[model samples]
Target: MTKEISFIDLGLSEEILNALNDLGFTKPSPIQAECIPLLLEGNDVLGMAQTGSGKTAAFSIPFLMNIDVNLKAPQLLVLAPTRELAIQVADACAEYSKYVKGVKVLALYGGQRYDVQLRALKQGPQIVVGTPGRLLDHLNRKTLDLSNLKGLVLDEADEMLRMGFIDDVESIMATIPEEHQTALFSATMPAPIRRITKRFMHNPKEVQIKGTKQTAPDIDQSYWLVRGMRKNEAIVRFLEAEDFDAAIIFVRTKTATLEVAEVLEKHGYSCAALNGDMTQQLREQTLDRLRNGRLDILIATDVAARGLDVERISLVINYDITLDSESYVHRIGRTGRAGRAGRAILFVDSRERRLLKNIEQTIKKPIPEVALPSKELLEKRRLAKFTQQVQQQLESADLEQYQTLLEQIQAESGTDLETIATALLRLAQRDRPLILPPDPVFKPAREYRDRDGRNGERRLRGDNRESPKRRERRDVGEMDMYRIEIGKENGVEVRHIVGAIANEADISSRYIGNIKLYETYSTVELPKGMPKDILKHFERVRVLNQPMKMSLVAGKSSEGKRGRKSNQPESDDKGFAKKRGRPTAPKF
Candidate 1:
């Protein structure tokens, strides 16, 4: 049996080793250990690994290290399949280059200023990482120089082949100096990629890493069911309560990383932005600050955050669903590394649940479902964290100096011990209001009406729904009462209940009377003695699929006329059964 070697023994600079230490990485991943040495010798290489197998770093590190910064032109180039993937590949290069000095990494794709890319190109990046079309566009315009190219990397080669980039890749490869080292990495080797690799280079080293596409095992995974409209706010609330040392929030695009980060910052989070648009220097600074705790949350596109590992990152949040299982594993792998336990919380909407199932099957484990943090729970969590901060600082305070001041304050105010402590705690929380704004009124929860056509849950009814300006609750005058299993937000219609009773109970619509909708359940009026048989069938009748158990509304209604009512069931937490919504835009 042979022993595995470590990354430090692989001839990386001490700085790279140190950065790896800070990133909580010790040994090179199999592909990295295998591919790096060969590629460093300036040989063309063919790599076969699954998605998320650390392919980006395998090719990027070699390409980045071999570049000539003195040339003041692109010495190495990487072509990615999509705009997001391009940005991600560029970000990976920039991250790996942080310890490698003077290596400028630039990303070019659609949706940004072309002139900006031109300017950066003119400024002389040591490496250009871009999508095929954009890279070719620059090559044609003569804005990008391939004269000094020393390396070329085709990342996700099969994906590019699938996207019809094989022809473009061939053309771009033709433009680069034939002497340049070529590296192609893909999860699958299609006929075209194999053909491309065969034609593009001399004998190439091939290293296939096992489980490269497999999800990291250290991450603790869970999910929450949420509606489309509630997702953003729910995510914000989760961030509020979560005890993240430093979190990386993955979105889909360079643009989304910025936009979402902007929203988080506006909400008073200590956050920083990372994307392909950032210069290599700025990208390093942002990462450095995060490592040093100058930043608490990092918002980034997956491309922008590739090859990024922060030891302090105890949490990984997938704000938007990635399109593939490979990307899903990659995003959440940012946390729970290096013998540390990590938590990955995925916010899933109705449409994205299918992705969740797909991930579960791929991972071969069932990820548990969790509920959104309730408003009250979020407040309690915030307060507890705030108090802990104060306690930690209080234990470290200079007692002699502050104690003297405190004595004087006690003497002057004649303050009791409890009074003084209360005052101090109050002062600590004054600026930091633990009380969050009231959560929006959610509709009542439904767990299906029973056989008797009654809801199993009680609706948390009235005085909660947001109105133009909430009106004062009127005292109740009871009318003959009836039951509705559906509550507000269930698409409950007075007419639906009226029609159900009018038809099933053989009761007139006029006698059906007034209706009220609550958080979990609704109530309506019914005429007395509508027929025992009719009532029996009526109890089993579903109004909007909710049981129509005849009973007086729980809350008092206008004019005390409580005919008769019985308990149906308490409503579920509001909004549990709202109709499914559309697919959400992946957090880029």
Candidate 2:
């Protein structure tokens, strides 16, 4: 077995070790243990590891220890892919260098004015972290001095490629001194990245830790399908029903943080909004309250929650799904820490299925589906909790004075004590009702389409090898025949009906069965157990610019071979079925 490596084994200075221990970390992760030694030894290193795998510490620890604080001419520089990541890296470095004196770290990213960054650069910080584009801009303006730079780190190199910054990254790296120490870290090493590493480094050491699952196994990740417009209500319903100590709900924009929090507060939930607009003093106080269990829910934007570690957060909700998969991973990582079981819930629309699938593929785990809690289930839970609270209060209470008062009131008013007690209980519970009104049912609206113009079914569509008798009598399997108003008379084609139904009901064409057209109407077969909402939408589908007005065709069930006259068209199988006890298809 491999021996466990502690922070001391990496030969970190006392200041750095003290910072790590203060943060409740004793042992170093595999990548950290492997890369720290080489980084401290002044060797160029290339690391391949997944996000959230202690990659930041692997380089930051050594970069902080080796920097010459007095020179203050950018001794260490880290390039990140996104502004969020830039801030996160800078924050982690600041924490690691807490005990080390005179190590000035500045984060430069876009969105803030250039003048702000220029002012900070004039201070001569020893370490700088920024995005490729922003860093290149600073280099072009000559505001950032790289003459004394000894170490350069490229963080999330593959993410930089995906964000179309590889050329910019190359330009920025080219400006670094030839003899500077370099390190490149990426989740994936594409061909271009490998070529860059070979061209830039001088016999660098490679440390690769295979992509381990970042999401903790203790987290129960789930998603609830909701409409785009009704997301607020859906989230409120979940919060009302689920038992969570504290939660961090993530939104897309800073404005949305306040808006979502206001909605939750309106619905009687204790919530606070955290965003970039807040002052630093206010943000720290908000965080302190959250950590001390005074805050129940916190609505925050992505950037505002960077490096926020709170153990009391038992749940994380993705109110708005992020386009970047890494952001989703980072948002959910706030919970399920320190071996405690946690829950992550994502609210998504039916049209966002592709996004959901992308997240699952990126995380390498399937998030199970969770339905909204029903009214009955919520009521049962509320009643049980109320009963438990009452039981506890009664067990510890001294009821002597209250019992004497109750007897006096009963004697004076000549009314039973139970009646007075019931009235008082009702008054006490008026502010927050134990039983809430039922929430509206959630239904997703999405369409399905097929590439082939045929009836949309994937079955064979070639010349019939069987005789007309055999073709007419073909088994329908376990399918239900339904009638549509559009037919040959309305200039309706098979593709038109297939497209209309597929797009309206969001059902695949493969699920559709045999279709027979008639002069007045048409008939199509579909599988059993279709969703009720989907079926309801199908009745409103328009084919050839007219409502199809579909409905179930009622009749007796037909079995065995269908017998028909030789002269009749094969499409006229409905008549033979009608004569028997079976439901008939539309006549040709």
Candidate 3:
């Protein structure tokens, strides 16, 4: 079909229709159109669509329209498994509520002050979205008054079941007025979840959508197997290493979203942060800038970014691997919208091998592993970007002031025009390094000899060089140098370093270089010309309060260093499930 479908045909209000038009929603997905009309008639919907299938709007529009913003008590309630999901559902409600006056959308989750949520609750929001734990807490404390609740939505119900929050969800539903309508959306209706639907929902209209479907098929997906130590640096390196008109980098947490957005903005990324904490006004303003092409890289948590169908998002970077197949599809869905071609990248950890299997199985396609952008490619991309910028300046710039300076510099310095232009080029490429910088954390070159006539292969001073029967198994192939700041002085052991890096940066202990602990620093062997951003962050990253500044030493050192090749876990995990049944940690 040439078109997906439109929400207007579903009979949304003129105000909502205008808002949708403003948001550029050309048509509703099959799920939205089918569910919206039924819900507006106050039907209890049992929506079963693949993740990223526009289910948020299916429930949100009807929920928003029914709320009497004038009556402040919570009228509609949605329970999510994770803090992030809770926040995101609330955000979608907020967006839809923009036209509906006086009704406030509040998100309740932990990891922050409860007083803040309580204060907002006292202000009388028309709708409440919350994780089960926090919602239960508020319910027990009497901060959340759901006596007037007319609608209850159970989002990611399968995940809540997996996380053992079904009891809370059932309890919450029980507490709500039995006469009210209820809608439950789950990727799969497991036995436990189905029980709730049977018990609570009255003559619910079921919408079941299946398949290990990639949500936005128009989007092209790629990934960089970056060493975990320096993820932010890797991000920065890759930004210079590629060309994107606009991108939205997805991180799992509000802290990460804000932190990465800040770093990108600082380094000239035209980026902004979208999270639950930002005001409704500021959120709208940021989206406005993004739509107008004034911003790139809107770093966001999944919850804060729901219904963010920005056609301008040319790239989607999964800074963290999503917890579920559905979220993976949903986050990437933000791009490639409206039949536009989009690009998406997922950052995976080698330890989560199980996740790779799950994702591949879930998507029913093999997502090939790709190497990080090489230093040479980064330089090329940077140079090309720099040239394009220069051309733009040449076309639009006011030249009189620069022309006088060019003429004066030519006379005084006696420099050729090429030389002057080269100087300008250098200036442009200075802040954003066109080349990857060498890291200090990796091991020294093994083939090379120390000034003392000892080969870099020789062990440290305390080691018994002549000792036989070494228990440690050395790889048969060549080894490379990789540096780290952790050492004996830092109370670090080989195993600790291995475990931490494996978990945090996705670096396998097998590929790790020779670790020589020093009083102030230590080094190991790693593959050459490493992605500088990942390397730099690893160099300064703290392993037990002492920063493990991981980097590749310039030259090769030992055996077993052939670069580079690219999981665990239980569960058939089949039968169409949502990404991250619970909220925060689904993304690795």
Best model per TM-score: 2
Which has the better TM-score: candidate 2, or candidate 3?
A: 2
Tens-digit lDDT string for candidate 1 (317-384): 88876645566787888887776779899876443554676577557688897777776997787788
User: Over 4 Å off in model 1, which ranges?
Assistant: 1-3, 212-220, 223-435, 438-588
Cα-based lDDT for every prediction: 0.67, 0.72, 0.67
Best-performing candidate as measured by lDDT: 2
Please identify model 2 stretches exceeding 4 Å from their true place.
213-219, 222-363, 366-384, 387-407, 413-419, 426-588
Query: What lDDT does model 1 reach?
Result: 0.67
lDDT of 2 at 43: 91
For model 3, the superposed segments whose C-alpha errors exceed 4 Å read 1-5, 212-220, 223-377, 380-588
Clashes of each: 28, 2, 49
Per-residue lDDT over 1-588 for candidate 3, one digit per residue giving the tens place of the 0 to 100 score? 223456666767887776664443546766777788788898899988755566777888887777786798999888877654665576567666667778777877665356546656777888888877778888899888888888988887887777777888888887888789888998887899879988998999887766454534466776555453457767886776656778888886666776797778778878888887789999999999999988877988776788897888878888877544566777888877776778888887543333454566666667776656666787777777777987898897698899899999999999999999878767767777665554323221112123121121122231221223432432423333565766675555565565454445453344444555666556554433455445555765445434576755434322223433211122232221111111111011
Q: Write the per-residue lDDT of candidate 2 for residues 1-588, one digit (tens) a residue.
A: 336888998788999988776553567778888899898888999999876567888899998888887786899999987665676687679878979997878888765456556756776788899887778888998888888889999998987777678898889888888988999999899988998899888899999986545544567899987632256657877886777889999986676787788888888788899887789999999999998888889998776887899988889999887644556787889987777778899987554554576578668888887887777777787778777877887887687888798889889988887898877666656545566665433224434443122122121221111113322232223455678887786666666666565445444444456677888888876654444435665775555435577786632234444623122234434542423222332211
